[model samples]
Target: YVENNLAQKTIELFNELKNPADVNKTLLNQMKLDDIQSSIPIYLSAIKAVSQIGDYSKAQSIFKQIPDSLLVENQIRSALIDLWGKVGSVVEAKLIFDKIRQPNIIEYTTMGLF
Candidate 1:
């Protein structure tokens, strides 16, 4: 039931961050109590939430926990690219883009379009 808990916690974290009220970073810190290596999906979900709320500092902090190998995965890479672009770091986005191996047409198109 660990997976279930993780999924539920992830949803809670997303909602808390998405609320119009100010975010409580403490909540994020608490979420990090979960096993990060196994909870990459939840962590990534939090990253997306923070990014959407313009909380790049917190999002970057979470992103850093994801290893380069994980970052290379298509789904994660797309999120990171978008995050970097959202934060006005086109150079960083390009750096990640350059490191991608066998980028599909969608990825290529995203790079060109973004």
Candidate 2:
């Protein structure tokens, strides 16, 4: 759905995966390592969709759904920097970028664009 540029549909499909209320700590605790790892990309896609909509509040909400373990990932933070920047929140993007110990090419490129 995302590849097709259907941002709303992508978000709908993502939301259908599980209830919003289940996206908290209890959900994280129930997921295995494999599940967490695999879901990272899906979460990233959802974030992208939210970014395309330019909804900062929705972006923040979708971001909060990501597992803490995933936040440490460079790709995740990079995507977030892009998302926040797209939604007119450079400050939030910078905050995430500042947390990265070693920014990669993608992160650098993303920050540069903003």
Candidate 3:
């Protein structure tokens, strides 16, 4: 279901479900594998959360888990670039920025913000 793999939806469900965090984490990961396309943002959010929690390695793994196709999308690429930048992932962020072709103003701004 779209509800399961969407980042906002996954986050929303996690907030609503008062079960153990492990349960939510497992469910989210399952949803991600089940729908990699829809799960791109979910993976990004996971990366952001892990990074914020001081788990840069985990965040990198989550970011790496994103499908290549999804990572090329404008919005998703921008988000990943911004995320890498904010987390001080210079190499990852630069690589992502370099891969963008014909980037628009938003993407330019996002890369610049790093």
Candidate 2, residues 1-114, lDDT tens digits: the string is: 344455574465446556332333233333333243336666776676777668777777778778789999887899899999999999999999999998889899999899
The segments of candidate 2 whose C-alpha lies over 4 angstroms from its true place after superposition are 1-38
Q: Candidate 3's residue-wise lDDT over 6-106, tens digit each?
A: 57665666676653333334555666676543455555555556545544565575665667778778777777777777777868878888888788898
Q: On lDDT, who's better, 2 or 3?
A: 2
TM-score, model 1 to reference: 0.66
Ranking by lDDT: 2, 3, 1
Q: What ranges in model 1 sit over 4 Å off?
A: 1-37
lDDT of 1 by residue, 33-91 (tens): 75344344654665576567766576567677666667767877777777777776778
Clashing pairs in 2: none
* Predicted model with the maximum lDDT: 2
Clashing pairs in 3: none
Q: Please list the Cα RMSD from the true structure of every candidate, rounded to 1 decimal place.
A: 4.1, 7.8, 5.2
TM-score of each: 0.66, 0.67, 0.64
- Ten contiguous residues with the weakest lDDT in model 2: 25-34
Model 3 alpha-carbon drift over 4 Å, by segment: 1-25, 32-37, 47-54
